[model samples]
Target: MKNLVVAAAVATALSMASMGAHAASPNELAQIREQLEALMQRVDKLEKENTELKTENENLKAADEKLQANDDYLKSEARGLRKEAAQQAVEVGKVKGADWAGKVAITGDMRYRYEMISDETLSSSGVQTADRYRDRIRARLNATVKATDDITVGIGFATAEGNDPRSSNQSLTSVFSRKSLDLDLAYFDWKFATWGNLIGGKMKQPFLKPGQSLFWDNDINPEGLAVNFQGGMFFGTAYNYWLTETSGPETNLTADTMLHGLQIGTRLPIGQNSLMLAAHYYDLSAGQGRAPFYNGSNGNTTDTVVLNGTSTAVLRYDYEVVNLSAEFNTMFGQTPFQVWADVAQNQDADDLDTAWSAGVLLGKASNYRTWELGAFYQVIEKDALFAQLIDSDFANGVSDSEGWVVRAGYAPVRNWLINATYFLNKRNIDAPTSAGQLDIDYDRLQVDFNVKF
Candidate 1:
């Protein structure tokens, strides 16, 4: 049988291969539903991009908490503006008070002096010889306080009385008390802008030139320490008091001591004119034992001799004194002129004599008149008054003495002053009873009325 005819042609070739796989199974189920609709449109676009990245991470965490609350409100407004600038710096240091408690200062001067003295020579202790009219009064008051800024403290009061031209002319109607308003000048001043001033208690002592009265006696006032300086060349130094002691010897042997002095100065200027130089030193002793002319009497004491039984007599006195001066002041137009010269030396007992003077002054004050013209010449050598009258025999061996003065002044109003003066004196004594020599001369005329404030 040919194997049943090839099994019927293999069952008709498996029925046409199952009809071509059922026609490709409806196009593979329509291409698997178009690939599941393109995978659900890409999972709905990845879930809308995960909800837009969670709303941009909650908007960057709310802008980082609003920038940390604006940095804590700018650090609490800068700590309340630094606590109101530290309470306005403590109320401006409590209204600025005490830096030395309100300082106060006052100064004063009042003067009324009139003097007239002429040819005096009459004194057997019953002294009287004059043609005079005198009245003097001076006043001063000053005060200050400023405990800082280079420190300062001051106080002063002064008063003066006059008429002591060797006492006579009714004793000048009594007012004898020159400078007793106490404390002429109490001081403490120090300023140094390159070493210029320094002062300590009881002032006024700078060799000479404070209106020059020819060395000493401008109503004598002196105490301690003083120094002054200026660069264009001017300097000073002082420590004063040549002698001071009231009453002793017999009222129980009382004693006091003080006699130490020194002063130095310098000043220089040429073209316009200015020149001054000075030096002075003194150290005197023997502070006690008053009256009886220091008991060493030698007027022959009516003859008394006792050798070893003790009846002694040995007289010689003088401690020390030295002075030197030079001056020249100038101004030609407004009128201010001065020329002065001086020399004084008394080395005491050892006898080294010198006393000299030369002067010239011309002045002017405007708005009417305040004139002046002066001339002077003086020489007292012969052992400088023989050691200043060594225990007096009415002052021995006094050889030469000369003087000259002429003055004129007028002020009209402001403090009132008027004056006129003329004086000339000469002496050459040596007649204890005429061995032949005693020429005395004098001529004087004066009138003055002054009031100053």
Candidate 2:
């Protein structure tokens, strides 16, 4: 625009200075003035265009700066997120390292029972003893801690008294007094091999006990070391337990009464059915004569019936038992059914040394509102098995007895069971008590409600 104005001014000055050249024409001056007006208008339009270009350049510069700032902010935020994620990963690893509680588990069960026992016999004067009734309960709590991948330690407590290897029930007495809890089970099980296990302390029966416990009570927890093996269809077990704890009374050095037992079993398939057969042998000959047999409960039984005191012994018998058991299970009309037999013999007894039991269980009470029924007839002769270790409720725990037990169980819901068992038996089939000899009928009724978790 400046150059245009300069050129216009020089032209006007020359036109005026040379006006005499066109002195004959006045129209030239008017035309020159009109040309000057058009130059001024062009200069105004060029100034407006320059101002708009400057404004556009400023806007582009501001936009470029805003974009750069946004990029820097995004980079900073990504760095913060990476740091947070790394911190979270470290915390997760620490939590995994401190997982002691996760490696342990807890389990337990509770059972309440009501028992009615009756002894139908006449005294020497021909009068019967009063019927007995009691309310009993058994409770257990156990914990299993995994110290290593293949080694587990367990400890448990139960409502029990003394060292009654035969029972864990404490009768409700002393007017609902608080019950006592004893160290019922404690053991360490090491599975060092794929087919064998070593367990110590007072633990569960390592040997496979048949449905009918002829020689050992189902509730007995042996205090000893046991090793069990299983390979394919064959399985075996061997263990030794302290039968009597002696503080010393007998002079003989070989009077330690220990129980050494062995068991071996096999399972064979017959068509679609299977049969499990087992043979068991236990030597208790060391506990006879000199050694004392305690009532597992109070350490007393008929054989060791101390005449009003603990010194004199009336009966003593040597026992070495060999028992055989078999179980056959099959489907009976869409439900499982089982038949089992347990027979044990004391090889050292002269007479009444055989004990046998056979039973059948129909259906299964494994689900909600399910039911099952079972019945068994057992004959345990005198001196067959240790009288102290036998079932306490059968034939009043007296040997030389034969009886039948009928039982039924129902499950109203999962994990809950209700059962009823009735034992009809006759006691003292051979030897006569001091009150002469009477084949006394013994009856017991038990109703139990049990829950497990």
Candidate 3:
């Protein structure tokens, strides 16, 4: 615009000069020069304004680019947040759909064992049998459900060769025949009071095994009703179980066999150690003179009786057993130590009715890299405990036996164990066993690999 104005002014001046030729005067020339100066000033002002506008436009463009970058970053962040939210929602839905899964618990264990049995038996023919070697396996699975706030239900299955209450081991034999899976546990426990519980069905023993006592075999699951109570340092258990049922009988004496048991104990703390003392009473009056045997008499004294038009051997005396047990636990530096003893007597038996066991354990085999060693000596006289209920591995599961049990265990990792148990025992210590009248040596070795989950 300045160039156009200047050109037009110059053209006009030239035109006047041409028209006025010699008539042109100095005044006209002065007027033209003044107009040229004004035009130059206007051009300088317009140039300054145009430079300022260009600077403002450049600043606006830079701001717009920065805003676009920030907007892209925000959009990317929103996408990530949406994905995370979706993942969380899926997890929440899964938990809501299986809410009852929290109330149920499943646990199981398996044991594989290599066993060697050596028995020294005396026979009239003077013949000796060879020692036996076998492999065995035991697997158990249990489920516990919290049915209600105060009620719990448990069910379990275990490998077994037969319905023998004293053992759950299935020997590996029979040309790969299928093994049996039997019901090992089925019970309901109700917390009827703050310090008491009512348990029924085929259930675990309610009595405490202070010394890991073998007076009652660990595998025995008694079908009965049990009540357990504990308050402060006092605890007690009572149970009644049926041994045999007799119905529609016509005889001189007829009744169902039953066993009743009660145990009471107390725990006393002494410094960092604790001591426990307990007394147990078991009565099987109804089983007297009854042929209520599962495996056999197992060296228990018996009387011959006629039943169902056949001759049979029945229990000779009632079993009214009284047991006293004590256990002391203490810590020696970082290792644990325990000492325990048990004495039992069947009051109804006239003679040979005493049983006793004493043991000491060093350390404990729990968690990884832990080990334990224990040894115990036991003497079970002929009429002491009910023979069918004793540990099957001890002295060939017979009464009138005296033995030593040495056990060692180690855990290489969590929930896995290696164990060895040796039994050096003599059967028929005082009286003849059902197998023979002569005393015999019974030795057994068991090595086990155990795993639990």
Candidate 2 residue-wise lDDT, 215-302, digit = tens = 5668878888889999999999999887666555556534667888899999888877789999999887466664344553211223
Overlapping backbone residue pairs in candidate 2 total 3
- Predict model 3's lDDT versus the native: 0.90
The candidate that achieves the highest lDDT relative to the unseen native structure = 3
Lowest summed lDDT window (length 10), candidate 1: 388-397
**For candidate 3, lDDT tens digit of each residue in 1-453?**
778878887898799889887887888788889988888788878988998999999998998999999999999999998999999899888886677788899999999999999988756676665799999999999999999999999999999888888989999999999999999999999999999999999998888986756898899999889999999999999998988888876664578788999999999999999999999999995778887789779888998988887899999989999999999999989999999999999999999999999999998987999999999999999999988888889988889999899999999998999999999999888976345655678999999999999
Per-candidate TM equals 0.24, 0.75, 0.79
Error of 2 at 279 (Å): 0.7
lDDT by candidate, in order shown: 0.54, 0.80, 0.90
Better of 1 and 2 by TM-score: 2
For residues 200-299, could you state the per-residue lDDT of candidate 1 as single tens digits?
Answer: 7765554465233333434444555656665556565555442336563444324333456665767788889888887766654553232222223322
Candidate 3 off by > 4 Å: 1-93, 250-253, 433-436
Off by over 4 Å in 1: 1-96, 102-346, 349-453
Error of 3 at 232 (Å): 0.4
CA RMSD of each candidate after superposition: 23.4, 10.8, 11.1
Task: Report model 1's TM-score to 2 decimal places.
Answer: 0.24
